[model samples]
Target chain A: SQELEQSPQSLIVQEGKNLTINCTSSKTLYGLYWYKQKYGEGLIFLMMLQKGGEEKSHEKITAKLDEKKQQSSLHITASQPSHAGIYLCGAGRGGGADGLTFGKGTHLIIQP
Target chain B: GAGVSQSPSNKVTEKGKDVELRCDPISGHTALYWYRQSLGQGLEFLIYFQGNSAPDKSGLPSDRFSAERTGGSVSTLTIQRTQQEDSAVYLCASSLWAQGEQYFGPGTRLTVT
Candidate 1:
């Protein structure tokens, strides 16, 4: 089973709308990375959160990690067409692992 | 190179044949990773190599899959006795250190018949 679980597998919203995506983990998240992927391209790193109750923002996007370290949420304000892509959340196994555990992902589409 | 480069941008192979995929990471990077994305599915970890130490192969799906780093710079992923289920987009990423953020490549699309 996936260690990281993402909610709302797919979402469609109109341009300029506000949206939020959630990621939950069975184990505490040592590192949380949010990436956006344009169709057929490599992942474009958005932000990384390490400490519990951490928050980071990039342009119109903001992400927050809960104090328990088991969940995180990404919020997008005044969305744009360029923001349409697959959003992925990945969690570390608290270090000493080969790689990060990635969630299935949330596919978001912004309509004009 | 400026970013990780993967070759044979696309590959089409037959079942039971062996296939090799190559990756060249950004210069001076010490950590490398291999992942596979299967037909709209999330990326799956395959192997990880850090510095000159032995690679961590725990994520390999089966014995049919193996990877090697020649000089802590370039790496190759080989799949033997390929099955149709092995088709996917193979991605490579490199980080400056063992626990740093990673930069990914464009990926190689593999199609097995």
Candidate 2:
């Protein structure tokens, strides 16, 4: 089974500051997904990275998959209160039909 | 268009009782998934359904857990003789294809007391 470990299990950052969350996998990553979840709510898809060295960005958030495909990072620029939540990283190996293994998630706290 | 919908947003059941959680995927989606998230824990894969193919039940935690997708649309996850450990949020997701991006539903919060 593949395992994903996220660094800085919990983080507190000032609004408008930049922060980065890291996800490391125990095995080669075939598909990496980033999602955000508000307290007690469902997860919202943020981005998906498949190829090694792939990077994708949406608005103030950017995600990058390392060339080794064993680690990924999510960086937030000029964070806001809305960014405060749980950020989770999920990985899938082989085919897409396979269920994803997820990290425990990083709890982000943005202080205004 | 609707993403995914789940019934009984919150359910409270007693130990030794059975519970059923329903999930309605997006229209025309061929892939549906069930995941459980316990407090302070990450999402755990429960099952996967793609088109008419047999569901992938590999992720099920135990034989007490089972699910069914009727007409390849709606899915129901049944937990028999629920225990306190069964308390968690059950989320449903759907994607246009097996490899496509998945959209999740609000999830059903089950609390077994």
Candidate 3:
């Protein structure tokens, strides 16, 4: 029952390598957000994008939303060991009943 | 206080037994949500509560699954007549408003034997 599909379910990279994860939805997106969760821990809010084609950045990570509003991508530059975790993209319909509709998530592993 | 917290990080129960999971949201957070994550699957919406008003129970998978939020703060999810299919990680999240950034708890891993 997941409307969003994340590609490359798992990624393994060298410590300093760069990588990208993609999230595509079957429905038009109103609000898109990213979260990261370490094993056995709670999810940490990463970023939120409202407008289509908008881009946001935090540290070495940059996120971009598609103009069609049905897709988004999270890019990690110079990935670090601390960046290893499960990255999840969630979409909301943007209304009174809006709650996060999450993807299966992409697990990233950074090796030194 | 500082973040959303869930009680009993892990719970083990036998089939036909009942179980309850608790979630405490950050003060002043108006929106609370419950979700279930099956092993190797995406999170499925369970319920949504805002303030003291009626909650959105559209996501309840079965009659045995129910939840209540008291005074717009603490909430509990009750599972009755538990089955093996009920085993999953139950997660709780709270936000100041709908579609806003949500704060999640550690989640309770429920195992039914």
Candidate topping TM-score: 2
TM-score of chain B of 2: 0.98
**Given the true complex, what DockQ would model 1 score?**
0.69
Docking class of 2: medium
Error of 3 at A93 (Å): 5.2
Worst 10 residues of 3 chain A by lDDT: A92-101
Fnat for model 2 comes to 0.77
Q: Write the per-residue lDDT of candidate 3 for residues A1-112, one digit (tens) a residue.
A: 3388898899999999999999998887877889999987778999999899899999999999994848999999999999999999998733445577888999999989
User: By lDDT, highest first, what's the ranking?
Assistant: 2, 3, 1
Tens digits of lDDT, candidate 3, B1-113: 58999988999999999999999998899999998988666688889998888999978999999999988899999999999999999999999987678989989999999
- Flag the better candidate by lDDT, 1 or 2: 2
Off by over 4 Å in 2: A93-97
TM-scores, chain A, per candidate: 0.93, 0.95, 0.93
CAPRI quality of model 3: high
Candidates in order, TM-scores: namely: 0.95, 0.96, 0.95
Rank ordering of all candidates by DockQ, starting from the highest? 3, 2, 1
**DockQ scores of all models, one per candidate:** 0.69, 0.78, 0.80
CA deviation > 4 Å runs, candidate 1: none
Candidate 3 residue pairs in backbone clash: none
- Residue-wise lDDT of candidate 1 within A1-112, one digit each (tens)? 3388898889999999999999999987777889888888888789889888899999999999984848999999999999999999987655468577788889999999
DockQ preference between candidates 1 and 3, better one: 3
- Local error of candidate 2 at B17, Å? 1.0
